[model samples]
Target chain A: MDKNLEKKVINYGEAIYEATYQEMQRDNNVFAYGLGADDPKGHYGTTKDLHLKFGKNRCFDTPLSEDGMTGVGIGAAMAGLRPIFIHQRMDFLLLCMNQIVNMASKMRYISSGEHCVPLVIRVAIGRSWGQGAQHSQALQSFFMHIPGLKVIAPTTPHDAKGGLIASIRDNNPVIYIEHRMLYKNAGYVPTNSFEIEIGKGRVLKDGNDITIVGVSHTVEDSLRASELLKSVGVNAEVIDPISLSPIDYEIIRNSVMKTKKLLVVDNGWTRCGFSSEIITDVAINCEKITCERLGFADCPCPTTPSLEKHFYPNPSSIAKLANRMCGGNIDWSPPEVVQHEILSFKGPF
Target chain B: MKNQFDIKKAYYLFLLIRKSEEKIIELYNSDKIKSPVHLSIGQEAIAVGVSLALSKSDIIFSNYRGHAHFIAREANLDKMWAELYGKSRGTARGKGGSMHLNDISKNFMPTSAIVTSAIPEAVGYAFALKYKKKNSVVICYHGEGATDEGVFWESLNFASLHDLPIIFICENNRYAIYSHQNTRSINDPIVSRAISFGIDAERISGNSTEEFFKATIRCKEKIKNNSKPQLLECMTSRWQDHVGVTQPELSKEEENNIKKAIKHDDLKNLENKLSKDEVLHIKKRVNKEIEHAIKFAEASDFPRSSELLENVYY
Candidate 1:
């Protein structure tokens, strides 16, 4: 926001790539690696050309050994090195749950502060296409439930760059979630390296009628919904909680206090999901508040576009929910506008 | 190839580990030490030999049954005793008990309770050492049961592919808790499995401290000189239960096997090499150290209740 600061317009993936490049250049102990870290596609371009720039020692591909490789990163971290272990899809993280949950997360506690696992596990959440069940999952809630891990899901290019740099420097294990749909969305990011404080939320757009909190890609939907709400004179406040684990409830509590109404939109399921957590926090801290939650329907994700659209909550649905919470006509529906990112998505990566 | 001074030191260490675990078995029933202990009674030689062969700068990642490895590294006896007693002054501040002992200054990394959990971590450390271009090798110690996990094979492949400077020592005591290795795995030797991964590997008797020491020396040299990983499947025996101090009931054949193992004890063999006066001196010194450690652990206080969440983060 500084007038004198230099900035460039880059997409979410490029922002992540820039952060990794800058961090590796700044710290010799920092390195990036994964299954496709050195592949031509470069893990959806976030890790593109990193191997060439940092050389094979610092940036390279790993075998299809998630559990082993994850523990390897954890070990490297304890031995005075920072490793960024990338996963092509969040769904595959299940393979290495033992390393992440039992080892990396507990290293500091079990060692009694003698060791710290400063490892970054970068995973992308999938959506659209026929990616289906195993290929697509938004499991931030699972990581967030664990005590020792710090989970972050950055929506914009700015936060993606800043959040990643912060995660790399953090002494605890950090799960960095990037929604695949947000990759092509461009935003103004600072040319210089920066760190967004972990466990902080940003007010993407300010209003007063109803508080709308979003997670990951749903933040974009919330922003668009806010615009639709404005036409109907229902001013909705939009919040993006970048860090999922140590969530900044104070920000949401403040917004909800003024608005006296809350609607949480999550990118995953509603049952035992992140939305439930946000709603519970606000409900506990505030009085006389009305709240509702939206996410994927409680079922396996269908592959067809028609069924998929119904499964996911979009801008129009979010706007209607906010409109109803603000005492507007519940039957009213806004014009359906397909997001540019969704329309431009070519195929399954 | 063994000098008199090195042989004496190795004997001293081997005897010390034996006496320390015997002391644990003695004090276990008193209920002072809180954690469940996995006794490394019969497998002392592997840890003793491997520890003696490695340089001071080399590192070790061990498993739950790590008392021998911890003792062989010459870590602070007082702190280790305090940790087993759940005292504040212990290593890991009493958070990690018998299974999770670690002395980073001694380069004995924290051991894990879950089997096969620390293999890839050791590989990762080796990768870091190689990346930093440090001339140090890591020794990863685990039971043969660890090979049952898929991550074990995965770690072996990764280490071989990267040519990491590491040595994997499988203490094949043959029992995973109550189940025998024959029931869990086929008769295929673990050394051949390692060789299949392109790592130079060999099998040696765990009861012979000198043989294990020589094998480990060769493995360490191969790792440091060629920057490749090696594996040693040390065939050994366990004298106690998988956990706790209770010895399991054995059949007639099992009893005879145990008697034979005790008869061929490496500690006794090492003692035979030393003079009576030298053995007496070593036993007296080790007994005094153990007594002092026990008193220190008894006197140390438990961690303050407020300190429970101190190290959950950085």
Candidate 2:
């Protein structure tokens, strides 16, 4: 019965598009605007036909001024409109740190709760095609550290739709980080106006030997690693955390109790990052659990395919790390490096 | 603009800001208030005059040196003073100090210290009002220094593009922390850039309350009749230095020029329109008000440590 309720197959980007469509259809006050919002690609098809569906006034494109437009969205959100402000690249958000941190985050607090900013800010992360270091940054850890910000990153098509709905309906500011690579991945999703509760995580593949947890696209890669681990006589559990801030530690704790082992994979850097926080959690919560961390190298991501091959971690690397922790007896040989199209994402970062 | 313009109230506002800023400087040597304050000692007329043209329902966004703007908005002097003192009962509950002074009930938002930040926020606020079909407009105040930021140009374009009900008031005091106007700005007039965005722009002497009031009234009319962004540059001067109570450091010629202008006095313009008895009465009343505010601020307690995390989230 539960399977039938969510029967339709949808890609990650379509799910986001559907969620935006449904949310706009549901609330007249909710509008989506940002750079390339009305472009032909519609921000990697996540915002396609939105301007045509709802008039240009409701869905629109913006100038190159990131900071000013961000403040404009904040002001609009404070005045009873739910604005979904999108940036093609998360790196552009650096220009408007004051708007997001000082203005949008503190508007309600300083107003003593008299004003509420129902804002949904969507940022796309890219990691390939020699986009260079400027375009290949995942600053989720930095944003999550700031107070009054709720960060949500969906790894599945189903969660993408629900998480966005929850973010738009939320009364505070939300930083919705979407991985571009996940936009092409498909899964079963519901067509209704449903919402997944924010600040929650779900176990994808359960096993008794090891618990492997990741966020966004890393979660999908971990699932692939779990399958590979099964062939190697290792039982690897997988988990996808839907939210970063207000992290649902209880789920990870329960998994740790069952497996007695934990490993965290972050989409960003490990230095002073979420992976570090997870390691600390295991040290404090489950003292006996063996642990490891995975993330970007603590340096700028290079552009060439040959250089990028060693730069980012893949499913093979993840499986190899898991094999080491679960008794290094498994035949975990590195696969033949498939010379990917120089343009295939190192991860759209 | 008929005889509705109150000479007494305008002079009273000017005196209120002059006395309050002087008091802040006088007390800065003491350790009682540690927050940085940008004094508008010589630019009181622009705020006082423009405020008379705005309705109580209109919202405002101000820059770092907005003490005079809030004073003209008739913000509670006690709470404002207490805010600078970091008292728990002050505006913004002491979370935002002098830089972010605001009274939402009066539609005066807490100003941001970031240069050019308030410009886009004002445009957004005006956009919201327009979206709701409300007649209320947003007035944004910024310094000449803010014009250098890109968001200022973006906001001007956005406001004009959407025909947002907003009047951007530029407080062109010429010196952005010792960088004179000619040294910092391009040769063309500042108002021309705003006009190029397809919005009406004007330049007025910041010392002339009469001209500033008339300009603001005309802008308000244009905004109400047909939604259009407007810009007004009021060329004023600051008697004191930026961000403190100390004398401004400048080249010898610049300092002499500033001193000569300060010697002309802020009350001289207002005094031309009021009787000697009226000037005396306004000064006496404003001083008493300033004195009471200072006493109240001094008596108030600092924000309790337990409330540190209170406003971090709504």
Question: DockQ of candidates 1 onward, in order?
Answer: 0.85, 0.55
The superposed Cα distance between candidate 2 and the true structure at residue A9, in angstroms, equals 2.6
Error of 2 at B47 (Å): 0.8
The Cα local distance difference test for each model comes to 0.91, 0.84
Taking chain A of model 2 alone, its TM-score versus the true chain A equals: 0.94
After the best TM-score superposition of candidate 2, give how far the Cα of residue B190 lies from its true spot, in angstroms. 0.9
**Per-residue alpha-carbon lDDT of model 2 for B1-314, expressed as tens digits?**
24367778888888898889888888888867758899998888889888988887899888779899999999888989988888876787677778888887778886887788878888888988987889888889998788888889999998898999999999888888878778877867789998999878999963677678888998998887895689999888888888788887788887887877777765676777888898888888998999899888889888788877776655
**Candidate 2 lDDT tens digits, A1-349:** 5653756899998999999999999998889899889999898888898889888888998888889999999888866788999998889999989899988888766655557678899998876777668887889998888888888999998999999999999988899999866778788888687899889999999899899999787897788788778777889889888899868888898998888888898888898998887878878988688989898887888887678767776778888889889887656684533323223544444
**TM-score, chain A, candidate 1:** 0.98
Please give, as one word, the docking class of candidate 1.
high
Please give the lDDT score at residue B121 for candidate 1.
98
Could you give candidate 1's per-residue lDDT for residues B171-243 as a string of tens digits?
9988898788889988899999899999899999747888888888888777757856899999999989889
Candidate 2, residue A88: how far the Cα is off, in Å: 1.9
- List clashing residue pairs in candidate 2: A125-A348, A125-A349, A126-A348, A126-A349, A127-A348, A127-A349, A128-A346
Looking at candidate 1 chain B, the ten consecutive residues that score lowest on lDDT are: B1-10
